[model samples]
Target: MSKKPTLRDVSRVTGLSMWTVSRALGDLSGVSSDTRETVRQAAAELGYVPNRVAQELRKNTRRSVAVITASTSNYYYINMMKGIQRTLRPTGRTAVVADIAAEGVYTRELEDATVQDLIQSRAAGVIATLTLSLDSVELLEKWDIPVVFVDSDPPAEAAMVPAITMDNFAASVEVGAHLAGHGYRDWLFLAYPSRWSTRADRERGIRHASERFQANLEVIESENDVESAYATLSAHLDHGSLPRAIVAANNPMVHGALRVLHERSFAVPDQVALIGYDDFDWAPLLNPALTVLDQDSEDIGVQAAQILTRIIEDQIQSERNGRPPRPAYQPADRRRVEPRLIVRRSCGC
Candidate 1:
């Protein structure tokens, strides 16, 4: 059996010194850009692959950042990717997405990573969107990689991982207040239970305002998809119990709840009002139009990327300054981007 060619083969084939080959392939500043391209082409021609681990040990630049998101089906996540791309494109950093799809009949979106997978990806840094198991977090910590959490809060111990998220609690509060302004006191918050910080924050915001409005607010836990929402609401409808107003956590739930109400011949904003979080483009097209919390999707991505980039730059600087690459600061500093309330007929506002 023939063994694979090495960087030495690339150097010989490209008529470059081993040191020049190494510097070119490593994308170091000392090598001319054209020389780097020529060496890369020669390596490809000779089927010579550089050893990433070997190069990492010798301090090479990382070409990619890892992004683990709960699902790609959600438009919010799709929009968030747009944000990430906007930030990463010009900087030459590309994202490798790990989207964990939900199994059937599940609502709370979560992701768990096997250590082998994490080790194999060799991601220089990680950006996670939803809830990752404590074990996964611990594993990443042990690997000593930078992490930036988005749309979810990091634990107290992970203070170095800066978080970018919508103001869930505040958004909920705004929704509840808006519903109250429309003269509805009985409200139901359709949600999914998750360890993810967004759930708890949203609950905090909604509950606080619900109390302030002196309204009877209840939580309706449902699976992440539309079918689960239909089932949950159907069960409630069977008992002839319905809140005067409903605030769904995301777009799918809003549509699902609306479907059930329509099936039962309930007049929207009259028999019941509807509001939701994470505004969708289709919201205004709904018969009565949905009132919602407008999350700044692109902005969220840009800010997160910028923060992570700054962190990485600082780490590189610290290395130059004789400091070891530190784990992102402890006790992640959370930045809560505000969600704008888009009032429409759904809330009778």
Candidate 2:
């Protein structure tokens, strides 16, 4: 087996002293531009890659932010990730997704392990899609790794943590009101479990709107995936007649409801009106099209990334100033994005 090239190999190839080669490779000011270019070319020819682990050990920081998510298959997450990556690109940092619930299930043990891994890697920061456990939050805090929540909330114990989320309660209320306008008095809400903090507010808003509009509402919970949503709704429909309208809580739930309706030969808006929480690219291309509350998930991601970046920068500055590198969150950092309803054929419009 061939041995890997080292800094010394680049020095030997460039005929430069180790100190000069180190300065050139590090992009430090002591090396002239011409010398730096020569060293870089030599290093490139030697196939020498800097050991990031060693660099991180020396710097006590990381250039990659970890996005903690559970359901990567959801379309909303795809757009959100686009926003995060786009925003982080100019900052010279990268985003890495850590799926604690890769199997479509969230467990305390998995959350703990993910946090432990991030701590071990010296992650720069975190952007979470669901509320993390108190222990995980504190552990990240202790390590000076800031967290920014996107489309989710921080645990109550960590109220000061930054979060960028939509006004889910108001958005769900709008969805309910639109259904009421369509005379959908009997409504069924297919929701993911409350592990996602948005679920409670969304349900509350739906319930409030239902009572105000004199509608009867039922809420059913499912695991955070299409298959679970499909099975949950399928089982629900086996015993009761279809409601006047169905509200799907998110992308996967929308898919599940649509699948159940199609398999049961139920015509949308003719027998069962439908609405969903998040809008996706293909929403308009569906047979009946989809009426949805569009929550600018990409913008939410951008905002979360911006907030995390700012906090990380502050921590870096604090460390340079010989202070503890705790994340400095501001009241304004807990921001909410407004959601708008996108009307389409699915809701009898």
Candidate 3:
């Protein structure tokens, strides 16, 4: 039987020094990017795979999971990441933060490239706030890795991953009812691109309650950025079709909408009411204080990490018992974190 190739073999084949080869294969810095790619390609051709789990065990290093998000600027994503880290700390695991651009914000190349990088990394599992495409999820399954989604649902075919998500529909319903109770009729819903999974669920909730209260609702789509939200609503303000309330889908939109309203002389809860989805730290400090549905992002993060950790443990146990690995597909395990509505002066409560 032929012996497996070693780092020396990769070094000899690539004509790089052993130290350089080691760093490249281990995904450490100090090697030029081109050289690392060359070494990696050569190693793949040679069928030389590193024993990632054994190396981590030998070094007594905590196994790592990649925590992925679309935008770090979102308070929701940031809080979720913090929660994931807090949950992982005591379990001898750590998180590697990775960002991806999704939903046509960039070409598929950019999103696929980021997922490729995650797959190539030595992380044992993944926890993501960004939705993974079906192809990307399949790739992860082909690699026999577990993924747990936080605040985003898995693609329809990604039946194995459990999603720790908010009950956006119910929360939106609560927000709508609360606003209706305050006698708001015309409504402006501020949101990011509808491609975002959370938006659909939230809108469904709002729609249900809007019908019940006989409220008129209109939705305006903006990019997921402060400047975009401000500019989008600024244009809306110019049309003079003022809704009695502006409901932002998330905190960043809240900031942008609030700025536009304040500058345009729309008094909160008097001329126009305001509320948003996230209960960010500054929500209560605003002049009229923003009403919000607190999603408990940290807890969602913690739950996602915990689920991923269990998947990892289950895989390890299977290997120890000489059982075939867990099946790549099972019934979807869905976990929805309920959101809470907090009424503040912003909503005229």
Candidate 4:
């Protein structure tokens, strides 16, 4: 049986010394551009996969990042992956995504395992969302990798990691303003738990809008499930009368609202108008197209990926100089992506 090819084989095939081949593959300086390309092509043709574990053992990392999300099955997350891919593809780097369980009891165990794997694999940076636990953050800090939180706001004292998420408060305010503009005086705010930063921010924004518009805002918190939302909205519908408008917090809630509205034989806009956050793909395809605040999922992914990349790059520079990386704000840092108010037939806007 033939043995697997190594750097020595690549060097022989490219006619470069093993040291030169090593530096080229590692992207270290001193190797000429032409020589580096030759070695790279030869390694690719030989189907050589660099031993990342060995590389991390030798130093902090090479040039790879990890993106951990609750699940890749959802729409918002799927779009976020697209954005991350768009940003990293040009740089010839890879974004490794670990999907923690979407549901059920094994979530904590799966999340822990995911973080441990990333650290053990010597990932240079990590982009995580709601599923990340405090213990995972502490574990990541002990490692050399820089962690980036997405859609999950950690405490301010979390210095080793910086969080990237939507300005939920402001985003909700836009929804409030839009409804208020359309004369939605009595309204209902469908909410979820404050466990996630996005939910908290969104609640804040809705509160702000409620105050500014002086609307009678009824708040209902649910577990973010179809049945929960159905029951919550159903109570409102059955008690007396539905509000003039309903602002669903996210896509799932929006879908739930639609079910209730349909069951009651009420017409959207003509009866009770509906608006939601997270403009999903099916928004326009609904019977009367959904009016929503479009959270640019791609933008979120792209910015998060770029920040993680920059942080990894800074760490590399810092290690060479025996100091922590200089604190600098990435242009993509703390980005509040604009949510466009798509006026559809549903809102009668």
TM-score of each: 0.75, 0.83, 0.79, 0.72
**Prediction 3 global C-alpha lDDT:** 0.77
Please name the candidate that would achieve the greatest TM-score relative to the true structure. Answer: 2
> Which is the winner by TM-score between candidate 2 and candidate 4?
2
lDDT of 4 by residue, 48-134 (tens): 777765554535444577877653444677788888888988767788777674531226778788887875677767777673667
**Runs with alpha carbons beyond 4 Å of true place in candidate 4:** 1-64, 71-73, 104-110, 131-133, 225-228, 235-240, 316-332
Residue 266 lDDT (model 1): 92
**Can you write out model 2's per-residue Cα lDDT over 58-166, one digit (the tens) per residue?**
2655588999998787888899999999999998999999998875789999899999898768789999999998889988886678998888889888889998888
What would the per-residue lDDT of candidate 1 be over residues 1-349, giving only the tens digit for each residue?
A: 7889987688778888765786678765457788899999998888888876656643735456777765455567777778888898887888777766453232323344433365445565778776566567766665456677888877776555678777787778878878888889898888865644688888888899989999998887876667778888888778858789988887667867988999989998888988887766677898898888888777787877777776767766765664545555634456878789988898876
For lDDT, the strongest prediction is: 2
Q: Provide the lowest-lDDT 10-residue window in model 1.
A: 103-112
- Stretches of candidate 1 off by over 4 Å are 1-60, 104-110, 315-323, 327-333
Where does candidate 4 clash, by residue pair? 169-201
* lDDT (Cα) of model 4: 0.74
RMSD of candidates 1 onward, in order: 8.8, 10.0, 8.3, 10.3
Higher-ranked by TM-score: 1 or 2: 2
lDDT for position 247 in model 3: 89
Q: What is the lDDT of residue 136 in candidate 4?
A: 82
> If both were scored by lDDT, which would come out higher, candidate 3 or candidate 4?
3
